[model samples]
Target chain A: MMTQFVIRRVLYMIPTLIAVSIVTFLVIQAPPGDYLTTVVARLEAEGQYVDRGQLDALRERYGLDESVWVQYWRWITGIVLHGDFGQSLVYSAPVSDVIQERLGLTILLSVTTLAFVWAVAIPIGMYSAVRRYSVGDYAATFVGFIGLAIPNFLIALILLYVSYRYLGQSVGGLFSPEFVDARWNLGKVLDLLAHLWIPVVIIGTAGTAGMIRVVRANLLDELNRPYVVTARAKGLPERRLLIKYPSRIAASPIVSTVGWLLPSLISAEIIVSVVLSLPTTGPVMLRALESQDMYLAGSFLLVLSVLTVVGTLISDILLARLDPRIRYGRR
Target chain B: MVESPPPLLDVRDLRTHFATDTGMVTAVDGASFSVPRGKTVCVVGESGCGKSVTGRSILRIVDAPGRVVGGSILWDRDGTGDPVDLATLDPGGPDIRKIRGDEIAMVFQEPMTSLSPVHTIGSQIAESVRLHTDLDDDAVRGRVIEVLGQVGMPRPESRYDAYTFQLSGGMRQRAMIAMALVCHPRLLIADEPTTALDVTTQAQILRLMVQLQAEMDMSVLFITHDMGVVAQIADEVVVMYLGTVVETGPTEQIFTDPRHPYTRALLQAIPRFGQRRAGRALSIIPGSVPDPYRRPGGCPFHPRCAQARPGTCDVVEPATVTVAERRDVRCVLAAEEVHS
Candidate 1:
């Protein structure tokens, strides 16, 4: 059943991704001028405008002089046929190559942050809910509210200051100066991990806090339900009763939110990455959008949209596996 | 001389109170009853008369702000020795916990919400079996299927893996009863187990419970507000009014010669088959149950009783009087031994 559901989801994503690509392409090209105008303006500013013929030749070579529809058609056909994402006008390289350089670092950071958030949020939320109004619950609730109130970037700035002042270390970027452009070796990976903690912790705070509130509320409601009472009356121990019954039910909504979290985390990373100067796709995507590099920005947005769709598909499959009501189409 | 064996459960003056924000509300005030082996004792009352609270108190499943304040719940496990006072034991202590689902299981009122929606019915019943007995996985599955079949669930093997929401209301309740009976508990506390189901389902469930009780030789403490249901299943009847037991007798006597005014009112309130009712409104006990915190000083039902004497009934609470062997009534008109 699950395999069939997953296969159907995969097939459905084909048309969805096509629609997403078209919308992304149109929105990128909807702006006033193409990347060629910006390139020509830079050349003219540097006193290097040779002739109008040369400019037209450059536009034709890049296929920018064609209609917006023709350019989208050519770009999509190239993508489908040869696994190409076209050229990045901003970086003067292929869009796939540019994305390849930064995608690994962004995925690492986001996944690490997500893991950190869930690891810390679920237990604390369970504790606060089960022992609600106790001293520990009140203290955890206070800290959670503070975590929610403080912005991620502001937390990043504070961590930076604390590290600089007390620890005497410059913690910007994903790697230290020595390993900045190093090859893929053990030392470089270790250094990357050492510097990875700050971004993960800073980016994870708001998400963890929000998740705590959601889990606590959901669990509190579930704990009062008749099923929970029945479990208790069954002579099941406290912890087992909690984890096996209400917690499993409460986790459905939390799992369903996974689809939205990926894109939102990437967007949040854009702002925080710019502040921390991390070598991730966040700042690169921002720069592409700012300079109107259509292929670069559109390719990044397309990947994000695909991730959103895939994330939702994964969450749905997981929810189906976890909840029999949804799995059997009873709900 | 031959003496009778002890009852399975003897609840004496069991008072369960809730400390609400407004004040302390006494839900079960001096509720005393006993369930003999292989017999069904039904506690009948209106919505707020504390029937369900009594059931929950027996199982020690009352939530926050509500507790069994004062009483002795003497549970005679095997009828061979002295009874253990359940009220004195900690609610979650190992002794009570072992006895809760193993020896005294409870089936809640709303089977729609009683079983967890995410878990399969087999696992739920298997949980109780595993908790009470040290059975292997195969043995537990065998017990679960056996109980399901006993409860008249169709296709027990296939239905074992069905979720609660997938089953109809009657099936869910059957699954609930199966879950309760998997351990072969000595006493089953069924709190309105069929109230939320349709008439046909209700009859089936009640009949199933009676059949199971006889087959297992397990006593039952049945709580319900429906007198018709009481007539169908109860061997003995205890009528409650405002947290107090107003009458206790055989089911036949309670139906025929009710001594307490409240019991009489409750029996009359049941719409009979051939009763002529051309233009009269339905017979009802006038005035709802009073605020638990501000209960009137005399008989709790005096305000609504047609035979109430103003000076005596309004001034003094009625004392329980023995009308006959194994029959009692709390009414001033029946007897005149006021101790308080």
Candidate 2:
């Protein structure tokens, strides 16, 4: 049954992704902005105002002289046939190659932030639930509410000051200068991770406060489930009842919410990453948008959309596997 | 268990309550009962009547907002001679942990939610055996197959590896029973375990419980609001009111000579074959359960009770008094003793 569900999910993804790609291509190409104007503006800003001669040469060189329809068709065909995502006007490199170079760092930050969020948030959530109505739970809950109230950028700035005030040097930055100078060996990796930890924690901490509340609500619901009472009545150890039985029962809610978490994290990361000047996807994507770099903005959006769909698909498959109630094609 | 397995389980004054925002809801208000070896003790009540709460409290499963404020849950254990108090013991405590599968187990309502969807039945059952016993793989597998067979599940071997989604409602209930009885727990706490099953499946599951109880010499705390099911399974009947035991007696007496008006009303409320109209269906208790937050000043049910003598019953709480050798009821109208 699990295998069949996984297969069904995989089958569902093909059409969904294809539709997403088509929508992305059409939306990106049809918008008023094009790659040529942004490139011309960047040059003009650098006091290299393009003459009419140069503008014509630039337009023809990059295939921007073509009509929007022709340009989109060419872009789509090139992507399908040669995996070409076109050249970035800003970076002046293949879009795929630029993404490849930066993808690892973005994933590292996202993965680290997520892991940290779960690690800290789950415990707080459980503690709040376990110590319901207590002073400590109230305090933790109050702090969590505060987290919701304060934007990540403001929190990021506060953390940056605290780090700078107590600890010497640029503790605010994502990577250490030493790590950048050192080769990408184990020592450098470890150093980079240590430096990266601060920003990850800042983003993670802010994000998890809300999730802590959500997890608590979900767990409370599960705790009230009839099976939970039965498990307890069986004299199953408290550990088993809470973590094994109720937690598993409550998992799908937490798991399903992860899809929403992915998008939220991108925006939250935008706040923290911009404040800290981290080399994370959020800042890059924001920069691309602000600069009106259409190819870069479109590619970033396309990648993020794909990630969102894939995340949701993963949640669906997990739900099918974990929940006996959901049978593919059965209901 | 030396004293002939000592009533399978014994419970005394199990007072469980919830400390809610509005007020304390006495869920299992001083409930006390026992199931003799191989006997089924059905706790019957309305939705808010604490039948399920009592079962959960006995299992030491009362959660936040609800707690076993006072109680003693003594259960027969295979490895120990003396019965242990499940109430004070942490559910994760070693003694209770060891007893979960090998000496005591539970089955839940809504098999869809009761069984973890992520795990295969085989593994879930296997986990029970693995956690609670020192049995080897072959022994565990053997026991799983045997219990699955005992529950009347078809294709035990194939079904073990199957997820719950693959099973029919009947099969799922059987699988749940298999998980519960994997180690032949001396006592089984079944909380409306068959309410979600179809009529045929419900009958089958009830039969399986009765048969298994006898085979294992187990006590059963069968929680339900269904009088028909209560009639089918209960050796002893405990009828609860808002959150207290309104009446309790032997199954035969409780059914044939019910003293409490609530019990009488509940039993009559069950629809009879020829007693129903087309639009108006089953008879209902006069009113809904009193909201716990703003319960009536005196007897919680005084507002709806037929036997309530306006002045006396609408003003004071009734006490549990002995009606006969094995019967007790909390009714103001019961025959009172006169002092010289």
Q: Highest TM-score among the candidates is held by which one?
A: 1
Tens digit of per-residue lDDT, candidate 1, span A113-219 = 88898999999999999999899889889889999999999999999999999999888998999999889899999999999999999889999999999989999
Specify the CAPRI tier of model 1. Answer: medium
DockQ of 1: 0.77
Q: Model 1, A187: alpha-carbon shift in Å?
A: 1.6
Q: Candidate 1, overall lDDT?
A: 0.89
Per-model DockQ against the true two-chain complex: 0.77, 0.41
Residue B87, candidate 2: Cα error in Å is 4.7
Off by over 4 Å in 2: A1-69, A76-103, A171-191, A257-292, A306-331, B1-6, B45-47, B71-92, B224-227, B230-236, B239-250, B253-324, B327-340
lDDT of 2 by residue, A1-331 (tens): 6788777778888898777877787766665756677677778889985788876875675478777566766776777788777767767877787776466777678777888888888888887876677887898899898877887777788878887888875865556776665667988777777778777777777678888898888887777776665455444667766888777766778888766677677777777877888766777777767766667777777777777888888788777766767754573
Runs in model 1 lying further than 4 Å from the true structure: A49-67, B276-281, B337-340
**Tell me, what's the RMSD of every candidate?**
2.2, 4.9
Q: Which pairs clash in the backbone of model 1?
A: none
